[model samples]
Target: MAAAFDIGLIVLLVGIGAWMIVVRDVVVATIIFVVFGLLMAIAWVRLSAVDVALTEAAIGSGITGTLLLGAAARLKGADAGGTRLSFPITVVAAVLCAMISASLAAVALLLTYPAPTLAPMAMQNLDQTGLGNPVAAVLFAYRALDTLLEKVVLLLALVGVWSLAPDRAWRGVPSLDTTVPPSDILAFFAQILPPFGIVFAIYMTWTGASNPGGAFQGGTVLAVMWLLVMMAGVMRAPSISNVWLRWLLVAGPALFLIVGFTGVFIADGFLAYPPAYAKALIVAVEAALAVSIAATLGLLAAGPPERMQQK
Candidate 1:
């Protein structure tokens, strides 16, 4: 029965994806894309990657879906007179997509005969970081530089988005639509949900050392809560020029860099923590990174500032 269910789900996913591609309406296609992401999350869960599943569900499906829906609304009727591809062009694109898919499948098949695994090495050194979760160790210790660079990239993306703002709105708040009033139900839920969300985010970050939770998952939750409050009009979005907000955005990466540099003098090299305080330092870095991740993700979703800050 389980096998049958999985097969059925895969069939549904393919069907929906085809529908998304064939459907000309942007709103419908965006909705289908959200469903696709949700199904992908389920697939991740079945693979025992709960952390990745959470991220897929939140950022992939939830936040992205919201952004696309907003865009679809604004772009309504803009595609009414858009040109359609010629039949030959459509066929050529289809053929190219099929060739790419076949190539990827062939590569996967070739790699499966002697499937590579990093579990052994990761497990062997997991204790060195004093982290019970091997995934956490890999992220914060074994591959710390990659993780740090990911955070830096997120900050840079935010900077790029801000740079796109017009001169008049450079320091203003970036929001989807300030004039769109929230429904009473949404406002009430926004007010009621943030406290619980905050606690959950903290729990995920703290317990990540031993569980299927981590900075990214926890930060995504925090971002979701902030977005809810802002969208619901419970609180105003912060201005781009707010000193405190800017600091919050950079604090995590700054701390991570400082900790990395400290490793050169105190331990072996960059991002190396002494054996005794490895877990403690990792936790501190996680806490700061979580804050920055949340703020950065929220601001990224908010896009460039459109309205001037009210004095």
Candidate 2:
């Protein structure tokens, strides 16, 4: 039964993905892309990668789809085509895609039956870090520096997004259509949904050390909730240059750096937590990271500021 499900899933993924590529309308293609991301998340789950599945569903499907829809709305009727692909170009593109797919499949087929991985060793050392989830142990302890850098990269990406704003709007709020009155359905959900969403995000972050949830997944949910509320006009978007906002944006990385440097003085080395305090420190880091990540993802999806800050 499982095998049959897996096979059907593979076919669906291929069919949906191909449809996305060939779809002419931008909004239609973007919607199909969201579906593709959801299917990819399911594929990851089938491979027993719950962590990857959560990330895929959250970022790949949710936030990315939001971004695309926003873009499509802003550029409505702007030269996006209904034209069919030229025969030769279409043939070439199809051939290239097929070759890439075949090569990837061949590589997978050629791998040893018992694939090489460091998972066993990672599990062996997980107890030292006192994390119950191997994925959490690997992310927050085994490769702490890499994890730290990942958050930093997210910050940088947000910076890139903000840089697109006009200089005069640098201190302004993202134009989340605050002036337009939200629909009844949207406003109703926006009013009631956030409290529940915030609690869920907290649970995801707190339970991460022992379960499949973590800062990234939690942050993504927070981001989605923020965007929803802003779009619904339930809450005004904050100024990009608000001091407190800036501080919240950098809070995670700053605390992470402080702890890492402290490790150089008191523990094994940079980013190292003493065995006795490993879990405690990791949770602290996770909490801080969730806040920063939430803010960053929210702003990124909101796009560059478009309205002047209200005095």
| Root-mean-square deviation of every model | 2.2, 2.4
Question: lDDT per prediction?
Answer: 0.89, 0.90
For candidate 2, what is the lDDT? 0.90
Question: Which runs of model 1 end up more than 4 angstroms from their true locations?
Answer: 77-92, 176-183
Model 2, residue 60: what's the lDDT? 92
Q: Pick the candidate with the highest lDDT.
A: 2
| Cα lDDT tens digits for candidate 2, 38-137 | 9999999999999999999999999889889988986785765547888999899989989999999999999997999998899899899999999999
**Candidate 1 local lDDT, 1-311, one digit each (tens):** 97887888889888988898899888889999999999989988877898788889988998789778866765785765478889999899999999999999998988965689998999998888999989889899999999999999999989998998889998999865445466677788888999999999999999999998888889989999999888888788999999999999999999999999999999999999998999999999999999999999899888889879878
